[model samples]
Target: MPNERLRGAVSARELTTQRCAELLGVDPKTVERWITRDRVPHRAHRVAAADLLGVDETYLWPSVVDDLRTVSAGRAEMVEFYPSRSAVPLELWRSLIQQARESVDILVFAGLFLPELHDITQLGERARQGCRIRVLLADPNGAAVRRRGDEEGFGVGLAHRVLLSLRYYEPILAIPGVEVRLHDTTLYASIFRVDETMLVNTHVYGSTAAHNPVLHLRRVPGGRVVDHYLTSFDRVWTHAKRTSDINAVIAAFDGR
Candidate 1:
């Protein structure tokens, strides 16, 4: 029992639970149950309530089930998939990154597009504001990049991309609350995690990362995909060498 009465998203919308129930033609207790259980009403009811309450359905009834800190929000599945990583809107990325207060993680091989796409300065500010940012990059000289290149039909070309991308992220070393490391694991996916939500790009058998679709996953009760990837990231992170130690190699690649 997580003090259901006091957790009032309704207050933000200027409505009471009783009024919400009336708008949905449900009993006040049912609405209370929905709140207590951290669940949303039926689709039609939620739509009506959203219209009546003047909030987006997502705002009016967010995925309480996937809110990592909440207890027992009910059993539900809320996974979204994108056609490609580039297809994911920039606004979503900015929102997720800006809103993250606890932890942020990135796992990728040749993540050259990330620095080009998002503002690294904003990420540094987030680190300054107490967000723990952990980044795992592919060891540019290691076998993992070689394997990834062979698999992607590029044959070591991606190693250059990895080196170039590392240069873009190197300055973040001076930022507090951040760690950058290099791993040699055969990467199966490129992950961008903000707190409990993640955008995972699964590597295709013989395609470049840009051609692969991205899966947007939120942590939800009774589901383990998000947790599974989180565990994978943790394992890789533990085995990775800190960039401070790997800088010699990065320097060797410079002026090439």
Candidate 2:
């Protein structure tokens, strides 16, 4: 059993032993043991566990337990939906993107990958209009493809084809405001934030990526905890790669 003091600090939601065990491919008993014994898992496993819990490492393995208690007590209104149409609401995406007068940062497997969605002229127009437009995408051709250079196999891959078409936005490489990267991590997640507001897309509970539900949440006044969550995203953005590396594969679909 965990220390009585420690038990007092962890919330019911954060103590999701059953869900964490499912994600870790372990029995719920094992998860309880880890928490009871205060045995920290490997770094990668802890990160995975945190993702499964829909919170950050700071929430799970924080240096100060009191901080976790403080944050876990706070809550925000949330909405969940799946945009079954060809694309998520363009107006909604644009609204979030446009709100970034200081910067627009997107991190996803494929950023605006649908041909129907590539509107850099408009995006660039936004950039030109002074909103700092930026993105961190998985390599457009990161996944192994049966076809030499076809773009329609994977849901995210198909969406990537549209992003590859707009190359003039060069130098949108992996530098602070702009980045493109590929990761094999199962943390296939998407986030959009405008100041304190955040929209999180979870690729869970669906057979495929496109059908997964997205959760939208806004930061209430005087509640700034979401900022730390956004900060974690910036950390991931900092490590992403450039589009140039996957140009060859993406180029093959020209005129398709």
Candidate 3:
């Protein structure tokens, strides 16, 4: 059977077999055989081709699961773990944001510490340099925010913090390639993605985010953890309100 997945991935990227061969340092016929004959490439080529096609190696070749399981690829994706979100170094956070070439995505209820740690204006410089920056905050007017506040014994304080965080993010909202959205969903984890590296803060009941454990994950071929979080981010991003709607909500809250 033909390897439709490989064929589709290459086609989706508009890469010809010859181009892929050139990049993979293989003969063009070999590339065609991998797709048409379902020939599994060597481990190195599998990794290289997957990275180039922007998909997991297993997605292209399901039978190549032995190496992933043997190496514990999921655990390998973890670069570090902090006892709590507060335990993550400020320098590490700064370095991640500063080094990001492609994207910076933040998903949180408030995440007020971000503005406190780094000047939010610096994100504009990143956007100018062609980094796509996305900030997803819990909508102050949403039920989830209120519920979170009550759960944390903060009452309306959490909502207020969200408003304040939005204020800090206000300037960057108008910048090209920088998007701010309001999500009302129950947040299980707060994800801070700097390209392929992510810091995932897992939420616990009745605990503030500062007290939550953070897993620092970098994407690895055949790993599923990072992709799971990325999919969650996309789902939330899809249904979230745009900047104009969030601004109106903030304005209304301020007026009252």
Model 2 segments more than 4 A misplaced: 1-74, 77-90, 113-118, 141-185, 221-225, 244-256
Better of 1 and 3 by lDDT: 3
Which pairs clash inside model 1?
A: none
Question: What is the C-alpha lDDT profile of model 1 across 194-254, one tens digit per residue?
Answer: 9989999988888888878998878874354676688789999999988864467676655
TM-score of each: 0.67, 0.51, 0.75
Q: lDDT for each of the candidates? A: 0.76, 0.51, 0.91
lDDT of 3 by residue, 78-140 (tens): 999999999999999999988989999999999999999999999989999999999999988
**Candidate 2: worst-modelled 10 consecutive residues by lDDT:** 144-153
Prediction 2 TM-score vs. true: 0.51
Q: What does the lDDT come to for candidate 2?
A: 0.51
Worst 10 residues of 3 by lDDT: 62-71
Identify the candidate with maximal lDDT: 3
lDDT of 2 by residue, 1-256 (tens): 4533323333544656676577688778766766788665565565566555555555555543444433443354343355532246767765765565665556555444332454445455556656565555544444422121233335555445435543534443323344344432234456766655566665543334456566566665323345555765767666654454445535654434
Worst 10 residues of 1 by lDDT: 69-78
Compute the lDDT of residue 111 as modeled in candidate 3.
Answer: 96
